[model samples]
Target: MEVSYREEGVASAASSVAGRLVADGVPARLAGGDPTLWGEDAEAEAAVRLGWLTLPRSSRELLPALGELAARTRAAGLTNVVLAGMGGSSLAAEIICATGDVPLTVLDTTDPGQVRRALTDRLESTVVVVASKSGSTVETDCHLRIYQRLFADAGLDPAGRVVVVTDPGSPLEQLAADGGHELVLAPPDVGGRYSALSAFGLVPAALAGADVAGLLDEAAEVLPLLSLDTGNPGLDLGAALGGAALAGRDKLLLEDQLSPIFGLPDWIEQLVAESTGKQGRGILPVVGADPNRSGDELVVAIESDVGDVRVDGPLGAQFLVWEYATAVAGLLLEVDPFDQPQVAESKENTTALLALPDLPTGAPAFTDGPVEVYGAATAKDLPGLFAELLHAIPGDGYLAIMAYLDRLAAFDAPVPEGADFEQMTDAWMMADPLTLRTLLALRTDRPVTFGWGPRFLHSTGQYHKGGPQNGVFLQITGVVTEDVAVPGRPYSLGRLQLAQALGDLAALETRGRPAVRLHLTDRAAGVARLLAAAQEA
Candidate 1:
């Protein structure tokens, strides 16, 4: 693994921070699994969270079992692998499978169309891997129940079709045991964001025919270098990230210029944003973000070639090193990286909204074509609404486009038979949210970030609420053409998705952050009108 910073200011700041860390013996202490680095308040959580520090070595024990499971599933003719998980549980697997060039369907949203898409196709040869770190995540639980119901409805035994990965005593374990499903327990000491090397990440990837053993080997080669004071990429990268954030360049614009590992930036977004974006300070990661040479942003290229700050390595080593770097960044920021204090607020709000006799319907400022615009009470048209959202951005702040619609449907075209999902997703034509993101970035100098609804609720949600109050949010929701039920749950997937959007909006509003919601009465037509208006504006 190699980490380099070419900019003189960044190099100077990083060197200063690194020199301080060397004097404090931080590199060796972190490698030795010392939990007191974050001080007394964080010691308890850090003690357990530091397990990731040794995961490159200790996780070798899981290979044989994961290999056997993969072999058995393949022998049973289950070629279609779907991972139903959320946040850390799902992001790592998504990246691993994508990088390994394997086909793995990832279900990380409550969008009904997406759920229906996963269910209707490849039913006979499918194997669903249910992963949840705490086993109590509402989205994961909803997916599990829906899958079980659908499988039974199709005359398939749910027991043989479902496999679970979670902590030992989590509720999912008991549920898995009750249903006679195979259970893989992750390390109790490792937190979800830090479980990339544990069973949570490896199980689904392995089942989908990824190079699991090779990943472990790559990570092992990088392990010994992390403990040394000199030539430690993890320490150097951490210092650079922490120092840059402290220097008012907290908005990280990450580009995958030539990285072979697909979806790596998304994984880094979750790890860094959630780990350090707390206590009124943190790094805000913008994946696939445009270059903003402005004083407020830092561009890091995740490529094998070049950048101001470049990180290049094998996939496995990349995972370990980034995790180490995040932990180190957290120490520099004086925040507990392991704890996501504000993440549960939206969840709690969603539950309350769902329990209501009817979901709360707020009054919209105006209706333009098929879209209902809310917030900025003065806006009367789509262009006016777009202008209002742009006008809300603070000088040093950013604009976040949060789409609660189906990500696949937004960015992807229909794939031809035998065509790859990645290829379809990268097709020439762009969709509503992507077009809006591009237009908005072109319209402003501030950093712009686009996130899929409930997924970002897990990734950057913490940062939006807990980190800085300078964010201006634009949330988009649409009508669900065909809503899917969550079996035992009262709310449908469509309702849960809206509730999540509303809940997140409520959180941001409570924080006094400038936010607006554009409701699409007709998903296709509404987005078209909005984008056209944006173009005209």
Candidate 2:
């Protein structure tokens, strides 16, 4: 199987990198194909073969470490497990513990409140596992510092309590040695995001009581199955998908349930988005719970468990099958199935924002005067209350009005230049709609900016802290029953706690900045009322 190199320069660079990897004893291979050849390429087939061959064969080597940690957790009686890291380093552990029925809490966000809540809300006997290949991820470091302070405040020993995972001679390993903490070294050459199947992800998965061994074995079996040929399911799928995407079909949809494959979609998103998104063309990868309905394009589902035969018969199968499908899709695109360009920028931006002392101010505030009231009460007479607020704030008072859910996407707009006011507003709008509306109401007639969402919030959350601040913040909170729970664990209240902490952090972000807190009993109804009031205002 072979892929043609398009731009000679790019091909040369790729070859140089591949050659270096080979010199370093890494099994490096180049898959190439012509961009104009549509679907005719051996690169896709090669990718499929390689992907299958690369799967881990066993998790037995990690079992001992996992057992030790689990025993420590049980012995120490820790109730919360904070896995600190970013990208693949953090995502794997988070997804496993968050999706599993574990008796511990997993905090994934970089928000101060998230760290605070993880430290303060749970029992003092919480255990922290800091995972990072480089050990210098700013967010992970910030979180480690926060945890250190909490440990100090609690008067607990840091050594033997916290675990640091990284390369053998990496700074993280050095820190762990100096701090007297347990150290788990990832393979030397393993990248941070790709280290999950290694000790990087194993420790947390085992601690969370997931079938880590099973997962690894499953992955190992998959490795040999992927080859750079149309006959290889993985490569074929990748090629077909990539071809479709290049052919102007920009949306790649993964059914629900398969969403928790953890970093899989993200991996694909980075691959497709970065590889194909250049030159004025890119696919918009979207993964979500398939509204249980389908139309137009083809649908394929893979099973999550092992020995699940992947039959392209029906539209949906299981998680493993879906992974195979992802591999195939990558082949079709003739691009490396891994790597993310914006990830480093994301970390850099977050670190820079954290280091900045002058947090943006002067944007609108939610309230002009002191707001002393705080309650978890649901609003009554929604329509009537909205009418009252509308009457209180008259004509053209609202520049933009969006529902709490809808406001999440408002920040998708590029930040304007020079106008600090617009930049801050965009940030606030993207952060929380409740905050944006309150600010708009307080400042009356300042062109409001915002968007709506369920997915938008996740996209813009990183930008809210990393980007320039330009707007007011109002965090909306409400109690909602658990609609879904990971099997076999304690009640899945972690999400609620996570949401509350996220909102709290957003509120605490600025001092003397306009912000409001509206606690509702019926979240859906409250959001409706908030939207109605915004429209009326």
Pairs clashing in candidate 1? none
Best by TM-score: 1
Write candidate 2's Cα lDDT for 310-371 as tens digits.
22311111223334444334434444333333234433433344344433222222321211
Error of 1 at 2 (Å): 0.6
Q: Which ten residues in a row have the lowest lDDT in candidate 2?
A: 307-316
The TM-scores of all predictions, comma-separated, are 0.96, 0.55
lDDT of 1 by residue, 395-466 (tens): 889999999988767654445577676656544234546678888788888888989989998989999998
| Cα lDDT over the full model 2 | 0.44
In model 1, the Cα lDDT at residue 348 comes to: 92
- State the weakest 10-residue window (summed lDDT) of model 1: 423-432
User: So what's the TM-score on candidate 2?
Assistant: 0.55
User: Can you give the lDDT of residue 1 in candidate 2?
Assistant: 14
